[model samples]
Target: MKTRIKFSKEGNLRFVGHLDMMRYFQKANRRAELPVAYSEGFHPHQIMSFAAPLGMGLEGKAEYFDLRITEEGAATLHSAEAAERLNREMAEGIRILSFLRLPDDSPNCMSIVHAADYEILFRAVAPEDKIAGQFVDGSAYRSLTGDEERSLRAAVDELLQRKEIPVQKTGKKGNLRELDLRPMIHALRCEDNRLRCTVAQGSEANLKPELLLSALFSLDTARPFAAMPRRVVRTELYDSAGKTLESYGTIF
Candidate 1:
């Protein structure tokens, strides 16, 4: 039997890398004494897989992982009980949100995740500055102002009017290429001090919020978000058609 776990990453745990989180879960599972299955080999490993791995320094309220367990164990281990047990074992910054038993034929969580919603909170630059029109470069590090708020709003409006927003992407071999982000951005909204965006996620055409912000600000695409101070939180995940994705238990 396979079980899907929904969890949240918060506080200092946002700084933990994907690999570290994997290892942490391994230890937590062991500590919780869940009857998890292990692969057959000299170097046995747990049969577990995570959905989308959240980027470092980015928090998430809806993260998922699937683990296989013995049928006998699954019968006895209720989902709610399992969640409670895991919560007790989880570290300070991580919390278990839900535990669900998936059907035998259900697809892997990672493959189903086509998009993700993110809330980006940061201090924008004052729009009154001469560089506000440019909207990029070193001017973003400054504080926000009423005039700048209107300027940023206008920028967002202009960005949405265009059919294609081209940005540069660097390949592994250091080659730079142009990529259009307009198609990937499913939705976007600029509010008082936050930018809410939903963009293409998963293996195909992933668009990071920082990348979108960089493009929106007309910054240099080759590391435009390097020094930006911001807090990113993933609020939801969705399918390719822009529908909210539900775990195994919520499928009904």
Candidate 2:
């Protein structure tokens, strides 16, 4: 049988790389005494896979991974109880959110990821000086004059109306190429000193929230948001039909 585990990474742990994260979970599974399956062969490895690994330095509100349970008593483990046992093994910055059974015919979590929602809060809020931190820019960061708020709002509006928003990407061999990010952005709104955005996510095409903000900042040079600190939190991930990964299975 297979199980999907939902968890969140925050605080200092956000710096943990994907490979390290896998090792951490493997150890956690053993510490929790779960019936985790192992690959067959000369060197056995845990049968675990993550769904759309988050980028380093960013926080995630909802994240998921799947595992194979092969022990004889695995079927008897209650979903909630499994989450509880796993929670005990998590470090301070990571938390187990849910455990659910995936249908036999269900697709891999990583493959079906189509879109993502994010909330950004910049560390700096003052109109004149930079307050560095993590987040998306909006009027909500700090007390902004009516004019400053309007300026930020106007920047976002102008960006969305453009035919293409281009950014440079480095190829595997270190070649730089310009990529357009406009179409990948499904939606964006700046209000309450925060920026809420939805963008294409997954293997096909991805648009980073930072690129969107940088584009907006470039449009209006009055406020230097590009140099300010950035803080981003991915709120949730969705499938092509607009459903969260959690919706595909039931949580106990």
Candidate 3:
């Protein structure tokens, strides 16, 4: 039986790298005594594959991984039971939100993930640094006291109106290349020091929240983005056509 595990990562565990998290779950599965399938080799490893890996220091509510178990194991280890057992074995920062049994012919989660939603909570800039008089909608400005929020909202609106926003990102091989982020950003909103955005993810194209912030604020020239985004949480995942895949709130 093939199954997909939806989980969440928060707290100090956000600092854990993808490889470390993978290892942590491997150990958790062993300690939980799950009947996980193994590869046939001198150094056997569990047959499991994770979806898009979360960046270090970023939290995710919809992380996923697929694993295989024998039919007998499936009967004994139901989805809810599996989640319960794993929760007991998992550390404080990680939680198994749900376990969904997939059809034998279903594609792996990693191949299907084409986009993801993220919510970033940031600290508002001080009044002295506000771009208050910039936006087109100035009628509602006097009533608002948070200069940072207004400035950020205006910036987001401007970014959304652009034809193309090019951003430079360092690739895995250490080469930096310029890529247009406008097409990658499917949806974006900034309000009250929080940014709710959805961008392309997975093997083909991925856009990190920090990259978007860097583009919006010009982190290189303007003040660094050190004060904002106190927390970032990935809220959901989707396929190419915007079809909702397994989510954190999903129940088996």
Candidate 2: TM-score? 0.89
**Candidate 1 residue 220 C-alpha distance from true site, Å:** 13
Off by over 4 Å in 1: 123-145, 219-228, 250-252
On residues 126-242, what C-alpha lDDT tens digit does candidate 3 reach at each position?
A: 555333232111211112236555666777788889999997788889999899999989999875446789999988988988888778776322233444435678988898888
* Candidate 2 lDDT tens digits, 1-252: 777888988777778888899999999999999988899999999888888878888889898998888757465888989999999999887899999888878888999999999987766445574433333223233443467667777878888888988888888999999999898999998876667899999999888777777677787632565675557889899999999998887653
Give the Å shift of residue 235 in candidate 3. 1.2
Query: Could you tell me which 10 consecutive residues in candidate 1 have the lowest summed lDDT?
Result: 130-139
What C-alpha lDDT do the candidate models reach, one value each? 0.78, 0.81, 0.77
Query: Number of clashing pairs, model 3?
Result: 1
- Tell me the spans in candidate 2 whose CA falls farther than 4 Å from its real position: 124-145, 221-223
Measured by TM-score, the strongest candidate is: 2
Pitting candidate 1 against candidate 2, the one with the higher TM-score is 2
lDDT of 3 at 134: 24
Error in Å for residue 43 of model 3: 2.3
lDDT of 1 at 71: 74
How close is every model to the real structure, measured as TM-score? 0.84, 0.89, 0.85
